[model samples]
Target chain A: MFLIVGIFIIIGLGFNLLGAFSLYRFPDVYTRLHGATKCTTFGTLFTMFAVVAYSLGRLVSTGEARFAVFIIHGAVAALVLLITNATGAHAIARAAHRSGTLPARAVVDRLEEKEEAKGGTPR
Target chain B: MTIYIFLFAAALVGLLAVAVLGRLVAGPTIADRAVALDTMNTLVVGLMMILAAVYDSVVMVDIAIVYAGLSFVGTMFIARFIEGEV
Candidate 1:
């Protein structure tokens, strides 16, 4: 159990570090968003799972009711992360693009083209 | 054994946050900085959970949950603010 928890923590931290590195290295805001959101979300999932596993292990060994509470709440928090992170990423990316921050190496922008077709803006 | 692991992991996370801080400081655009802030919130919640575990406190876990909920709303607000919808 300890070994498994350790591995999960290591993986979570690895992904987080990678995400931070990508945040520094990525060429544009979109790519930075891609790295930061995805890696941190997934990494957080691993860390929360390890916490859940540890709580469960304690619940089994000591039969403590509070450990169960910890497990449930940890799971809830992880679920929140899973759901909200993606939607937040979408919101941020749209906000960035709509505010006119285009990607650095874009061949085309379908959203822009559609907006142009709709006569939203003359440019 | 377990305490050490949690402590080590927390330290690594702190360093990771510091790395993200570079972008938060240096990002040219508001949206870029917003993204970094969002990432940091998610990570801080994770750190809170780990702290809860280390201390054997159910109360801390509940706090983490509340923090996550609030941060989600804050992220949306920042997005809308940047988009001129707020």
Candidate 2:
């Protein structure tokens, strides 16, 4: 049980570090957001999983209903993290583009064209 | 002994958060800093969960839930400001 906990945490930490390093190394804001958001979200998934496992293990060993609260709450927190991270990423991406943070290798810009066609002025 | 390991892992995450802070400080654009700050908030929740496990406290996990929600609001507000929607 404890070993599973350790493995999840170590994996989570690795992903977490990768995202942070990618933020520093990525060439531009959009690319950095891509790297940071994906890696960190995945990393948070594992860390939260570790918490779930810990709570379950405690429940099994201690045979108490109190530990069940940890299980449910930890799972809920993970679900909340997953949902909010995606929404926040989209919000950031849209805001970045609107604020004129263009990608480096700009070959296609269908969204910009579509937005302009809608007569929405860039603020 | 197991709790100590969890403590060590949480401490390691805290150190990583500090390292990521360098990016927040050095990010060239507001968006870059915002992205880094958002990632750091996610990591803070992870840290809080690890501590909850170490301390064997259900309330800490509940706190993590609230923390996640508050941070999400903060990130959205920053994104809204960056979009010039404010």
Candidate 3:
């Protein structure tokens, strides 16, 4: 049980590193959004899993009710992360693009150009 | 044994937080910074959960849940502000 929890934590760490690395390495806001959303979600999932596994193992080891609280609360936290992070990332990316921050390497900007062709600004 | 795992997770989260900070700095627009801020909120919640396990405290877990909900509200409010509807 301990070993399993340890492995989850390690995986979570790796995810965190990837997310953070992308944040630093990406050249633009769009790329940064890509990294921050995916990496953070993956890392957060692993960490939450570790917490759940640890609590369950402790529950079995010591036979306590409080472990249940950990499992439930941890699960809720994970769900919140899933729900909020992806949507928020999308909103930010859209807002960035809408506001005229183009990608560093882009061949076609259908969204922006289309909005312009329609005789109005990209709202 | 268990505490070590939580500690490792915390360290990783800290690293990730640094990455998000980089985005906040390099973000070309306010919206990009908002994205990083949102990601940070989730990371903080995860960190709190790990802390709860490390300390063997259910109270910490409860606090994490509350924090998650509140952050969601805060993120939405910020998003609204960014959209210029606020």
Could you report the DockQ of all the candidates, in the order they appear? Answer: 0.85, 0.81, 0.67
Candidate 1, residues B1-86: lDDT per residue as tens digits?
88789888888887777778888999999999998998999889889988888888989988988988898899999999998987
For model 2, the stretches where C-alpha displacement exceeds 4 angstroms are A115-123
Ranking by DockQ: 1, 2, 3
Sorted into a CAPRI-style docking class, model 1 comes out as: high
* Per-residue C-alpha lDDT of model 2 across residues B1-86, encoded as one tens digit per residue: 56776888798889878889988998888988899899899889999998988888888989999999999999999999998888
lDDT of 2 by residue, A35-118 (tens): 888998898789888878877888999999988988889889999999998999899998999898778787898888887889
lDDT of 1 by residue, A1-123 (tens): 899899999999888888778888888989999999999989988988888988888899999798888888888888888888899999999999889888988898899888888988654
Off by over 4 Å in 1: none
Chain A, candidate 2, TM-score of 0.89
Candidate 3 clash pair list:
none
lDDT of 3 by residue, A1-123 (tens): 878987888888787777767766777878777887898788879988988998898889899888887788788878877887777777777667666678888888788778889887644
> lDDT of each prediction vs. the true structure?
0.88, 0.88, 0.78
Q: Pick the candidate with the highest TM-score.
A: 1
Tens digits of per-residue lDDT, candidate 3, B1-86, equal 67876787787686666667766786767877787787788788878888888788888877887887787787677767776777
Q: What is the TM-score of each candidate against the true structure?
A: 0.96, 0.93, 0.90
Candidate 3's C-alpha runs over 4 A off are none
